[model samples]
Target: MTENKNNRTITWIVGGILILLLAGVSVLLISEKKVNKELTQEFELEKEDLENQYTTFARQYDELKLTVSNDSLSSLLEQEQLKTQRLLEELRTVKSSNAREIRRLRNELATLRKVMISYINQIDSLNRLTAQQKEIIADVTQKYNAASATINNLSQEKKALNQKVTLAAQLDATAIEVTPLNKRNKRTKRTKNIVQLKIDFVISKNITAQTGEKTLYVRITKPDNDVLTKNDADVFAYENRNLRYSIKKYIEYTGEEQPVTVYWDVEEFLYAGTYRIDIFTDGNLIGSQNFSLN
Candidate 1:
């Protein structure tokens, strides 16, 4: 009976040891699951931070394009942007806790940052050179303008001296007289007795004027400001348009004081008012006079 009791005690001790072993294994499994959850959470956080950094780097690349102007540099920047986008797509597809892919992307980001810094330095150098060239061009242009102005001033002075010499060489007329002749070829003051008009003038001598056959035109303006012309087609250039003349005469000008006479026949009705006469030669109004009749 004592031996039977000892055997029962040994059996109970073996059962208790088995139960304790199972409990220990259960506790170990639960603790292992908790540790695995913590490691996954840490990896997930690290992945999220890496993604955020990639996004920030992309934004910086976009901003950098705005600061540059060179076409070649801009193209390079576009290529870099494409590379960054491709890497970001790859990062998105990779699992958050994939340590290998994450580390590769991080290294790429570092390399891209170095490349961006190099491009920035190159762009700055190009901009500074362009500024220096602009300054040099401005200085050269200022000197050219100053020289051009001096040449223009000298040309104007030369033109002015030539004009003074031309003016001193112009001809003149003096001792002008007009006579309204009657039907019997005698001067008359009555409008009804006038049949024609005679104009007499003396050309003053000018040694500077050329000796040649000269044509002179006489413009007769009536009281109503009407010019009496033999024909409507009889016109000469005055300012910029044709002007009607009453009569024209030719003379052999010998640079001496010589008398000249020209006649105009009356074909239109006359009025008892003041009349004006102007004589032109070589595009110059050398003489002007006025007369009145009853």
Candidate 2:
């Protein structure tokens, strides 16, 4: 009986040990599963945080790109940089257990790298374009300066040419000769009643004249230093203004010098003395001469 009792006690002890081993294994399995679950939850949280951060960074980069200068290509480059950040985040988030997802992330990362390279190339191209634009602007400015200088030179030359033409067309004052029919010398004395005074003048052959109606004006000085001219109401056209003349005559003077004859009857008293006569035509005092009457 004691042997049977000892065998039963040994069986019971072995069974209890097995039960304890099973319980320990169950507890261990549960603990391990709980730890694994916690690790999975932590990893998911980390991945989600990375995704959120990457998304936020991408948005910030986009907004920053929008604020870039209008003339720069930095916007595209920044976009690629943001894309690279997002792809890196995705690459880190995808687990090894999800092979397809990891592969997708790898592909995305490769695409992002290509896009970044493209942006780099674009930057190089933009730099080249900027240099080219600078050169073009410089060329245009130089051309404009040259053109302005040429125009200024042309204007100066034109002004000089105009001055020369005007000088060539000018009329001289000493080219007129006059004569009184009965005037012999400066000391000749004349009666108070003079019948008429016949005046004659000659124009210089070098006088530049146009073929137009030229009105000649005459001003005669009497013996008493009196200017013998008609009143302002008897104004006549001569030298581009209203003039007073004792007599009016029209002449068609060609370019060649010609003689002009004018006759004036003295209605007023003519004291005998030296008399000066002025002839004008075409905005110039063409000639002047003196004579005496007896």
Candidate 3:
């Protein structure tokens, strides 16, 4: 009996130790499951944060590209944006619990930020250079405009001076006289007795006038206001157009007062009224006179 009781006690002690071991193992398993759940939640939060960071970086790169005007710089920005986009896609696809991939993405984010800072610096430098160029161009344009205005003013002044000189060099006529003559070359007052009309004038002395052989034109108008010309082709240049002239004569000018006479033969019937005569030289109407035949 003593032997059986000792055996029973030893068996009971072993069973109790087994039960305790099982309880301890159960508690350990529960604790391990809780820890794993907490770790998974933390990994999810980290992955979400990393993804948000990549998304924000991509937005920043997009904005930077829009602000860039240089082709090379814009291209670099585009490439960086694409890189960020690709990383964002990778982060989306990666498992939430993947610590290695998340760590890699974090490192890439830091690198991209540094690159963005460099791009910003370059862009600012280019903007400053462009502003300086604009200022230089504006200054040059202003100077050109001022020079053009000065040249224009000088040209106008020269034209005015030349006009004054031209006017001063023009010749003048004085003492104009007209007479009616008969066939015997005697001065006549009767319309039927007149056979010709004569005009006489004196060219006043002008030191500024040129000494040369000059052509003079004469126009005679009857009392009926009809001009007498040899034909429709009897024309001379006045201003910019051809004007009818009754006769033309050439004379030598010596810059001294000189007498001139021009005659016109009358083939048409003469009337007992006043007749007008105009004399022109060098595109100017130098003298005018009137005569009457009763």
Candidate 4:
């Protein structure tokens, strides 16, 4: 009986140890599962924040691009777009808590950003087009004014010139740019066929002269003091001594924001030198601008 009792005690001790070991393993597994769940939850929240921020950023960028008047700011925009794309890619690779559903959400978010980028580019292009159109209109107006002054007999009346000078010059003209259509937007160069410039002025509504034709001339001055002249007598109406224009344009004065533009061919071989342009018409110098070619 004593031997049997000792054998029974040993068996009980072994069974207790086995039970304790199993309990510890169960606790460890439960703790591990809880930690994994929390980590996945945190990651999901972070991903959501990133996605929301990226969307907001893209929207803001588009709004800002619409207002972009300076070409220098374009570089900053492209950089922001690249960063968003990289973040979207990273979001895609992130391991979500639920391997299926969360991953799908991240992928969807990335795709949305990609689509947004495309839309942003399209908006940028549209804005560029609109800007170009305004420039063309201004150019036409300036040229028309110049041609009419030379051709119209009514402009010879001194009182008429004074009346126009007083009112038309007071109305403010918003400056519009005439950048080349094919420009890459990364740099500024005179080598392109069309070199765009901006014209800003004010037109006064009250004038002494009866509404008729007003002549405006835009003469580009090269570094050699030689004025850029044109062969078209209509666009190349005389300003100072020569037929002055690098790009000749004509416009009729309805008197509003007269943003004008003219084109220069690459065949001109613009050397490294300082170039300037002056606009003349309506018995008032409307505007002037200058830039360098290097």
What is the C-alpha RMSD, rounded to one decimal, of candidate 1? 5.7
Off by over 4 Å in 4: 50-99, 153-294
- Writing each residue's lDDT as its tens digit, candidate 4 over 190-213 gives 445334434333333434333445
Highest TM-score model number: 3
For residue 287, give model 3's deviation from the true position in Å. Answer: 4.8
Instruction: Indicate the residue-level lDDT of 117 in model 4.
Output: 67
Candidate 2 structure lDDT: 0.66
Cα deviation at 220, candidate 3, in Å, is: 2.2
Residue-level lDDT tens digits of model 3 in 1-294: 999999999999999999999999999999999999999999999989988888998888888887778999999999999999999999899998888988998898899989989999998898898889899999999999999999999999999988888888787778888888999999988878878888888989988989999999999988999889889899999989998999899999999999999898988887788888888898988888787778
The local lDDT score (0 to 100) that residue 92 gets in candidate 3 is: 94
Screening candidate 2 with a backbone cut-off below 3 angstroms (N, C-alpha, C), the clashing residue pairs are: none
Q: Would you estimate the TM-scores of all the predictions?
A: 0.66, 0.51, 0.78, 0.37
Task: Please provide the root mean square deviation of candidate 3 (C-alpha atoms, Å).
Answer: 3.6
Give lDDT tens digits, candidate 1, residues 1-294.
999999999999999999999999999999999998898898788778877877887787788889788888889988988888888888888886688888898899889889888988887898898889899999989999998898898889888877876665666767778899999999998888889889898888988787899988989999999999989998888888889999989999998888999898987889998999898888878888898878
What is candidate 3's CA lDDT for residue 277?
81
In candidate 3, list every pair of residues with a backbone clash: none
Residue ranges of candidate 3 with Cα displaced over 4 Å: 1-39, 183-188, 223-226, 272-276, 284-294
What's the CA error at residue 217 for candidate 1, in Å? 0.4
Task: Give the 10-residue window scoring lowest on summed lDDT in candidate 2.
Answer: 180-189
- lDDT string for model 2 (1-294, tens) is 999999999999999999999999999999999998887777666556545644654565565455445444665656566666758666575773464675465566556556655655665676688889999999999999999999999999999998887666654444344433334423223455445566777755655446556777777777676677656575656546676666557777665667777776556776666788877666566677787665
Say which prediction, candidate 2 or candidate 3, comes out ahead on lDDT: 3
